[model samples]
Target: MIESHNTKGLIFNVQYYSIHDGPGIRTTVFMKGCPLKCLWCQNPESQRLQREIFFELEKCTGCGICVQACSEGAIELFEGRSRTNRKKCSGTGRCAEVCPVEARKIMGRSVTAKEVFEEVARDALFYQRSGGGVTLSGGEPLAQPRFAVSVLKLCKDAGIHTTVDTCGYASWDTVQQVLSYADLVLYDFKHIDPAEHKRYTGVSNELILDNARKIYHELAIPMLARVPIIPTYNDSADNIKATTQFISSELGKNIKVHLLPYHRLGETKYERLEKMDLAVLIEPPAEEQMLALQEIVQSFGLEAVLGG
Candidate 1:
């Protein structure tokens, strides 16, 4: 949260009955904005601090509805999706206003906590039938610690299982507050090397590791460390060993470590934001390579989950 204010699930996306995020079927709330810019990010739309407009090039009929709706002339026709000059846009909610077909659209919307709980409550029966609840994911849920804590506490009050999928880059105090109401913490550790971590993700891992260590002192809840195995980034044999050794010695082997195979799911989102071109970036890791890495995790006496 760049600026903390009490908010509901900021960007709610109901992923019905999924077994992967956590125990049983779960609903994951996709929060927006992240401190890290991992090269293999799969949800690029959730990378901004505010609701941003993106062009659905395939859905556009060239109706020019967006152009007519732009109050600041921020949107204009381009090679494909409307060329959005985000530098000048005020986030006025105008360009996406008049688009009838949703060619011009926003990725996320702010929802009140009560309203969000109502949506989650819709699956209360499912949660009760099977031990599944809500999973708060990112961009980085801790980024909006206040609202996230509210929602997590609300879920705990309602007897809903709460899990936070975070990079663990926040302050230990905030992390402790959020974890107080969470039943599980899916912490992320991409690269352990501080220099290389900064080079790619734009942030050092020192704070992240510090928070994780401190949070583990009151480790009453279950936590799983998720590592996104990026080829040529943190996939080397030495990196895996260092990460596994650290987790084993610091967080303990009881805390599981999972391997998330990088994918191109959010490749199109980069084009929509016009942030930077990554088409020439490295490809996803091969399945065989993924299994090999999983074996390494097992070697460190930890169970390895293939993909998240």
Candidate 2:
């Protein structure tokens, strides 16, 4: 039992009433920081551990309020547009505070486990009625093991079903810590091939696959394999077949596979975070393509569902 409710962790969002994350309407707590740098990451702002500024160019009116608010002089008008010198800016959120149109915003916040749990518990009535609970999502929940454990433990103590959504890139010990409290695990299976996985997510799938096996065979936890069907990446029939076969042979046939179709929803987030949208040109998988992949997954005698 985690006795400390004061352990601080960085989190970006607390989304309530989310149906896709777990069994029912869930409140997904998006933790800050991630080890994997996937090309098609939906939460680019969640990549960094510390608080960062989000400057929406279209929302800025070039009124120079943020310029005067920033003590570091990080903000300067460049042709009637506010530009930030990220190196000079310390993410103090002073500029974001004074932005009239809400163009400038800070991405993440530091909060205690108790504080987060209190907010999560606010939606207990909704969770009870819908058979939903709280989900710990990324950046990668296991990246901050202690904080994740604290939050999960708090939810579990309160009788809220806990789920950990992870990339399966963390250590076995970290996975064990989270699993101690998590009722379910949503593990991301990016690609079957390690080389391709590394090429895309900047990490090998060797540890991920190994962790999946450990979690399934050793821990015997309720697990769901979530595969994001990218158009030109991991959507091929060969990769899909390999993924299903691995689950059937290594992990068990009872595990359900969620076939998630990749979308450009996070593309605009890159603009706000001042990062490049690497997969901007990539289109979402067609409906027919997703259905075909579902067929391949079901062919392995595994239940496959489209979207979370």
Candidate 3:
């Protein structure tokens, strides 16, 4: 039945030697389709629910191979150039199939739990040496909760240290299932204020906060709360204080809060995906801004650290 229905997780990449995700030298499996759309998202290509193809216009070399490969006549060539009619195209990856230069990328691919585990466990020697295993990152892994849980359990059963990097925008059931097997949970705490969060990330944070508290109390797992320090969204001195206060008092020592500076890598993805450019609205926060923010939050008698 599983093979008949083609049930599989859509993964973008399996990154090796990743140090920032969890403990030392981990393999990060980036699953696609996120529930939230934060403006400053570093991995915008992972947002869509379905597979997407990115065409690098500069690398095209005006090649018409993709135009000829389309069976639906979805691709068009004009003025010595190739263009995909967004309305006519289905994003079925025909264009990507013929682009030999790797300029065309199908953003997501369906892979079985066994396939993913094999790739992850290939780095078993590295994991054993460095105390790292696999970290499941977004889009949002819980968006495909069943697949995420299955992979986590397989890793844990194999005696591999497992970490789940999530936005915490999933249902309590989904969160609980994955947490049942995860060793460390890197939870993203975007914003505290619901209205502000909605304005920035296109989602409310009520459930996110509730889930975080549940993880602290019910799950009681070792977790690190990450706050992306976007200017005008959640970087105010007052907001950081409020966030750290709640994290320290309510969440306990099992959790620590780290604030990250906003970045612009997602802007190019915005252009590629024909989405709006949010980078123009704000700049990356200054170093002094980070120090001040850290000081204010640490003054709350918490062990707040930087650099993940």
Candidate 4:
């Protein structure tokens, strides 16, 4: 059902040598766009499907150069400073190119599967030495299903291990396409309750939970469940217990669960993207709390690992 093509995908960053996304040291291709609007998203720039301009007010020197460079008249001076009228911006990136201090930046760019493969292949030596490979991360890797499958196929064809770190919110067909090439799948679980999940992620967890079960029972892909232990969100002992129970009972497989501690690392990124409302000032779960949650999962006869 999966077919490989030369389709292009919108991506924000091609992170080289990431040890956290998957096993060993791997190159993480961060695709732009997501189905969820989690308030605590670390990469706010990846949330939008389209290319966006991030203007840093501190870096701007009140220069009108961007105004002159924008062909769509997207920029203008307001209250003695240049402000980008996003509605008028065409995303041509000319304003970013003309900026003197890099105050204006384009967040996403379109790239073909071949181009991505070539860039990631530069780390072949590292992948070979560390038992590492390529990982497709998001926004939701399956959000751009065609590009994700193509990239995964390319890596696997080259005899490299592949992993897909997804939020598990795509169609079964799309998920199957990614599974066709991925050696491992890193599935993200936010909340066990559907109402709570919709409140936090702005999407019902029905699709996500259903997809996870299908991946486990039908495809039987070697998968790891990753949970972001956020404070005041799903960090309650009751919630953790429910999660472990669901994993053990529903999936019916003894799979290891990775508990990711929520951190404030993505706070600044929201500010940079001018989406500070999405930034939540929450503290990372304490070490004691993380360990306690790990114990809960282990109590259910499963291995629980802290972090990726």
> What is the lDDT of every predicted structure here?
0.79, 0.91, 0.81, 0.87
On lDDT, the candidate that comes out on top is 2
lDDT of 2 by residue, 10-60 (tens): 999999989999899999999999999988888888887888998889988
TM-score for every candidate vs. truth?
0.92, 0.96, 0.92, 0.95
TM-score (C-alpha) between model 1 and the true structure: 0.92
Number of residue pairs clashing in candidate 3, backbone atoms closer than 3 angstroms, sequence gap of 3 or more or interchain: 0
- Whole-model alpha-carbon lDDT for candidate 1: 0.79
- Find the 10 residues in a row with the least total lDDT in model 2: 273-282
Off by over 4 Å in 3: 1-7, 276-281
Residues 92-211, candidate 1: write the lDDT tens digits: 777677777776667678886666666677788888888999998878888777788777767778889988898988777788777887888888988988998898888999999988
After superposition, the stretches of candidate 1 with alpha carbons farther than 4 Å from their true spots are 1-9, 79-81, 276-280
lDDT of 3 by residue, 174-202 (tens): 78887888999998988777898898889
Best by the TM-score measure: 2
Arranged by lDDT, best first: 2, 4, 3, 1
The residue pairs that clash in candidate 4, if any, are: none
Q: Runs in model 4 with CA error above 4 Å?
A: 1-5
How many steric clashes between backbone atoms does each model show?
3, 0, 0, 0
